[model samples]
Target: MVGDYQTLKNIIEQSLLTALFQPIYDTEQAQLYGYEALIRGPSNSPLHSPIALFDSAVEHGLLSELELICRQVSIETFAKLGLQGKLFLNVSPMVFLQDDHPKGATLSFLEQYGVAPEKVVIELSERYVVNDPELLAQALLYYRELGFKVAIDDLGSGYAGLKLWSEILPDFVKVDRHFISNIDKDSVKREFVKSILALGANINSKVILEGIETEQEFYQLQELGASLGQGYLLGRPELLPVKILPSVLTTHQRKVKYGNYLDKLASSVFQHAVSFDSQTKTGAIVDYFTQHKHLHSLPIVRDQIPVGMALREEVLELFASPYGRALHEKKPIIDMLSSQPVVVEADTKLDEVAKLVTSVHDEQLLWHFIITEQGRYIGIGSVRDLLKQLTEQQLQQASYANPLTQLPGNVPIYQKIDDLLTKQQAFHFAYFDLNNFKPFNDVYGYAKGDSVIRVLADILQSYCTAEDFIGHIGGDDFIAIFVSDNWQQKADSICQHFDQAIRSYYTQEDLNQGGIVSPSRSGELQKYPILSVAVAVVEPDVERCRSHHDIAELASSAKKEAKKRCKELGKSAVYLCQRRGPDGL
Candidate 1:
């Protein structure tokens, strides 16, 4: 603290902090969503990292002063550069929102640069503990009323931010980088993103993911319905960032690509239905149900908001007893409404709907759920419809799966690689071939050949994580497209494991010689080594590669090279191609 004190003091006193803009992309729309203003101290100073600089500010009781300078510098530079799209200004709630802090400073600063309040997003940083929810909320509401939008920065960074989110419900949610970094390879992170996206959808808050430094991360975020992304892959922080969208990364429009109905949104099965206002008389609803016997249940609304669903059976039973009509004829329909109804937004994914339907204790509500748009009832859907679509989707996917190993076959494998290419994701393509499989099959018989294939399948499956695609390309050939960077180590591990595992398939006599005898094409007996797997790994420069066809051709060449390398190495080995793209070198 002694050595760093004067440097931090000098930076604060001199107002040496400058702002750099990092582009936040609208992944779905293929447009520039906005720039998150990142702050930096003097490059030569030890406080160059914003974390250290701000932490030093807090230690020196200059947090409020430092934040003010950062805000002013960020807002003014954003306007001076004429950077279009929203300007996200990160604010420490503890320092900036304190009651005694300068109230008109933001407006005055924006006015100096001629930047509109509407174009600025007041981002609340979640690094500080928010002891006063009311004060923090009042500050956000103040910004909202001042013609500025608000965003919760670093959501999931801590429990405080989570509570702040529920209380504030800002226009944007920038999820913490912790979950976004390796989401493609981590199922837990993927689930976390799924839940956050679902939460944002229900509340109509746009979800933004930060720290998407890889194409795999971006594709994973988009596939999970993330609306905004920010990281070095999109753009690094610059004094003046490029205004145009990155052509290669943002070229493809987001498509609804799913292997099955599990990923489909709930709106796919939407049907128009009538809803009753809560004030409507019970007798009137009963009369309407009687006239329309086909309608089993209907949603109840209050002032254009769905309150609950009303079942026809419950309403009819309420009136069937003697004197029941006189007892409840004039009562408002809200009284007999189901205590809790299954309600979903129009854009909620079908897979999510299925989870809610299956977990529910209410038998009727489980099947019949209300679908709403912006909290107003639009239609109703039944479980029967959801199940039918799911069944059809499963059967379709099953048809494409290989009957032998139950792994996805050629069609799905091709589609997977093509989709990654279309999304501009760079990945490793590993082609696997059983080196002596046919000879082993010839000598050991077909059943043993099948077991050998299954053994290879099991080995491949072991390497399958959330980020890699493993597919059976038929016969003795298979493929693995790895999104993670550690595929090289995995490729080595696969070869080494296969080298040892294949020996188990050889009979004692064959194992003794470490070879099998089979007839050659000309009918001469030939000796073949025990079955060994050969892997060819290709890292295509995605910019030059167009489709999976190009990848398949490259992989084929790599496979041939791997076979050559296997003969030279006298064991199973991975051949990594030095050449990239369709035409090697």
Candidate 2:
């Protein structure tokens, strides 16, 4: 107690804080996403422990000051070391709750280091409970509005983290080491990981698994289809972090996005085109259009800014008319500019560009649109090209979609898994089979069973985020590739929802008795348990599972295990397998 006060005082007064960076690997993309800025006190000091340091700062009534200095050190070090990707800075919510919390200090620090606000992620940990969630949310929202990204750190470490995630909708969710440790040998831990992935997928948050230390744990997460990971296995925290992940983490698989893909946009179809400076003569613009013959309009640029568009036909007709050539040949083409043309950012997706193109009330302006990169004129695109691309995408999707559930069919499901495996990505592939489904079909007829299958499909689809892929693999069997970190919880949620929903299908008497009287395989009467989904989850390994076919076999074995568990429990059950493909890779 005697030494604590002097230590804290010296720590703040001497500016003894420093930062170490830990790389976060994006397994899906097989690239380094960024580094997390971990703050540390002097190595030999008792305050060296980050928790102890921050706790002491809070105890001594200097948390805000300590946090401000920490941010400055992290930003400065990150810049000085020439780090690539984002820099995640931890900030306690209580710091923001302070009356003089040094507003804009982080941004100012960022500016001083020449770090763009968008490249930094402000991480809020759930370890410290907030007295006011609304105020914390507002504070995080303010950072977001200021161009900095927000993340909920230490997710699953406490109950408040989930609630905080729902409120903030942060860009990333960092799972605690407790969940990632020994997950390979622990089925329950694996299930927890699946649940977290599932939740992250549904809410569109990138989940980073922290504290991964062993080869088994690393491979375990990769199998779970984890998107981002940070720990000793990937790369340990150091004063200087590596820009690229180790070769062991690198893969040669093709990047695949089936139903969830939206990379194509207005920029995809934008044509690099010639532009006329606003001061160019009208006659010269007409002459240039005649030389090209195919160009409909020429973008008018003034000082790298798109001001308007000069129509080829409008300019030509005026000059071609009687005495028209002599009347306007020498004047600037600014007069020939049509009403402000449809201008769109190059990266705007097809659907949005479609709306902007169609929403134009004027018929002339609808013909072409200007595409800009960072507000500077880059190229032009025609509505016809945008529509053509949109139509092709829709048709392609429809061709691969199943007729019954309207979900991706066997081709897409296979392709999705094949791509993931080929790219050396880790993803848990769950094969779903309806328990006692055949017997139920025998008793209730085929059509009712089809309805039951559709209901199951809806349940899976409801939980699927854009990152998750759900497909119909023929009839009672379906596949869902969990790209979320919280898939275990989601898998449990899936079982919960399916169990409750299936009860509605059974007649009251049979449901009361707990199942229908169905024909057995031996043609004898059998009292089967209530209808439920038996889900078998497996994280595919690139070395063992060469293709989706190998995954199918692994999942088949897992399904048998799940069926056994379901029989004992008399309800939906999930079985996660960590077996090598067939005999071994």
| Best candidate (score: TM-score) | 2
lDDT of 2 by residue, 108-175 (tens): 88889899999999999877777888898899999999999999888887658878888888888899
Against the reference, the lDDT scores of all candidates come to 0.82, 0.83
Give candidate 1 misplaced runs (Cα > 4 Å). 2-6, 96-99, 254-585
Please provide TM-scores, in order, for all candidate models, with all chains considered together.
0.45, 0.47
Model 1 lDDT per residue over 520-570, tens place: 889999998877888999998888888888998888888899998888887
lDDT of 1: 0.82
Error of 2 at 386 (Å): 1.3
List runs of model 2 lying over 4 Å from the truth: 1-260, 398-428, 435-477, 480-493, 504-530, 537-542, 556-570, 574-580, 583-585
